[model samples]
Target chain A: MEIVKKVVIAGHFGVGKTSLVSRFVHQKFSDQYLTTIGVKIDKKVIELEGATVKMMLWDIAGESSAMKIPKKYLAGAHGLFYVFDLSREETYRNLDTDLFELNKSLNGNPAIVLGNKSDLVEETFIEKLHSSIATDFKITSAKSGENVEEAFLQLAKEML
Target chain B: MNLNEIKFRPLEKKTQVIVFDQKGKVLETDNTLVEVNPEGVNIFEDTILCGMEEQFLSLKKGEQVELDCIHTDFFGKESHYDFVVMRLEEENPSYGLVIYDFGAQYNQLFDLQQERNMAQIQSHRLERENKELVDEKTTIERLYNEMKDDSSSSQYILVKADSLLYNLDFKEILYLEAYGDYIKVHTENKVYVTHNTMKRVEEILPANRFFRVHRSFIVQLSKIENIEQMSLLIRGKDKVIPIGKSYKSILLQKMDQL
Candidate 1:
């Protein structure tokens, strides 16, 4: 039996969710930011611990609040990757509330919070952000392909 | 026209129809645009369809559910579709899936949305840049004010002469004297003449340190040694500056005396 899991990539507008998915799935990165309409699905197969896992990544349209996301798009999701641009403070300033609402829909599904665009920010800024937020997040860069694979694999491992 | 002679036109080529049982097993297909799997065609193969099973199950006979912007790559080509599922009014009560290929329209919308999003991001970036510039300007102005305050006692006035500029220290000046079209700046060591007026020189000097005692003379307060009834003598200088009758009272009020 093939283990297939649906994972959702969600965040505010222009948060690099699409870029992260493209970098991880296709090993391609683009500087152009074209907004996602509705949902775009991409599949990737990865080997972990002697098991093959097929992950269906659903890139949902961006909304300012998690509650504004279409419930259907998040339905039957086994994992979630909540991404935010590190250089934009407004993207994650209300993270506490956004995470609370997103978790309510997940029903205890595994989620990884990612602060993307690490190349645009300084190391001190990343340190300060870690101290200010209550949740733990991994710093990744879709442009530099830093930690992108690890984050997806980590979520896939947790989902399995 | 007779009922037997009447003919109906076929549906558009882009539209595909598939009939499925309640368990999502495809029983019949009238597909022209999409390629069907040789073994089977299951609605469960589409994740979106699986997600919408509840809505499909509750749909009554003759009632249909519509889902827009459904994406599929089943034809070996990426395409967008709008799907309509209707519960058939039959003995077996099967479901009919009508899929319309709307790739052209969806692509148009995608292009428009892409432009709007890019424009918004550009506007946001410009706003951030403008705010940073404003903050930098304010910081520079603050530092300039603080530096000006710190060096208040040792300020220099730039005096232009012939082809050179001179930074005359305020403490070294004895007094300013008007000479026709120019003002002579006398210091402890020398007298430097520049084309200026006493009135303009008074305004440039610090009000607390320099005072206008006469129409032609603006003396440094610290350079005054002795004040007589009609004139004042400069410290360490033999020259005496005449005090104007109209300016005597105010000049006396400005000086410290017992």
Candidate 2:
């Protein structure tokens, strides 16, 4: 039997990767912010082109604590969601380094980008930084849950 | 540990030496399409490779014999390293002494590598099988726990604060709202009011996961989906579970801990 598909969400700390998952799973919002330790795994059933894919989402630690990158978390993974807190320009600037590290770890694995907190933003920063990362990956928001489903849908298309 | 850390050696060339084995050994050179590798051959008297030992298996149980062997050679001009190869089994008449053909020798070497890879693959399969067996018990226990927590199948009997019942499946009872000398036991279909204190019900139900959200209310943790300050939105309707000031800290901790 084949294993379930796993998509990993990775980005700088407080980029709201966990919040994105909460928005989709719980359909509710928690304004209280808390740091994620190590990893947080969540599941969602997504109906792709023709299959009901059980997406096992692995939200990786985003803290800048000089912690070692976990390799086993990346293994058996089929897609990557690289997130950025668009409300903060510095977080957006750090996207290049994040993409570089992801490429090195994944060995050229496919990815999609997320610019969270779009409700707080004036414009889509993903477009401005489009040239630095693969155009297919960049997307905007979390507060409004805008473009969230599209991100994973694009991933399903590439992986499937 | 990272799989990338596991090093894979690239193929290179090498030279080999040959040796002979003598003793009262039963060596047979059979030609029954035996699968073997030349590089792994073992020489008799501990002088040849383990591969060559198979030839002895072909030999009689107690016959003494001379083994044939060739010096290990490299594949390319830039290749380095060497080996000593030998065989004890009688040469097959169908393919006699083609050992002199350098290309043939390399083909034998390739066969040897393939055999080694096959052996490694077999070992990996066994290790995975063993790990699966070892994890079976833990996996079952986890699944059983998940099932038990969600079943909430026990029949609950709500009683007065003046009395507590020993038999209760607190899971089936959705919630309890206290009124006067009677506390209501709200099961799936009907609500039965009993003269009991919310504290008494809280003592019997699972705490940490369960909560006493309101002054006169006790709610199952899993049943609450949303909390707006003091009010909790319980599952199944627009109803809310009120949170007492004293219970606020514990409820907040529960919300953040997960």
Best by TM-score: 1
Alpha carbon lDDT of residue B43, candidate 2? 32
Give the Å error, residue A152, model 2: 1.4
What tens digits encode model 2's per-residue C-alpha lDDT throughout A38-97? Answer: 456666777776677766677775633212446645555678887777655545565666
TM-score of 2: 0.36
What would the per-residue lDDT of candidate 2 be over residues B1-258, giving only the tens digit for each residue? 111111122312221222233332312222122222344443332221221334434444224333222222212221112221223235421111111223445446546544654454356557767777889978998998777666545435444433544344666656778887677766666666666677777786666456777778887777777888778876776777778999888878877655
Q: Residue B257 error for model 2, in Å?
A: 70
Given the true complex, what DockQ would model 1 score? 0.41
* Candidate 1 chain A lDDT trough over 10 residues, lowest sum: A1-10
Stretches > 4 Å off in candidate 2? A1-3, A65-68, A124-137, B1-258
lDDT of 2: 0.56
Tell me each candidate's TM-score: 0.72, 0.36
lDDT score of residue A25 within candidate 1: 91
DockQ of each model vs. true complex:
0.41, 0.01
- B-chain TM-scores per prediction: 0.60, 0.36
Interface RMSD per candidate: 2.9, 25.1
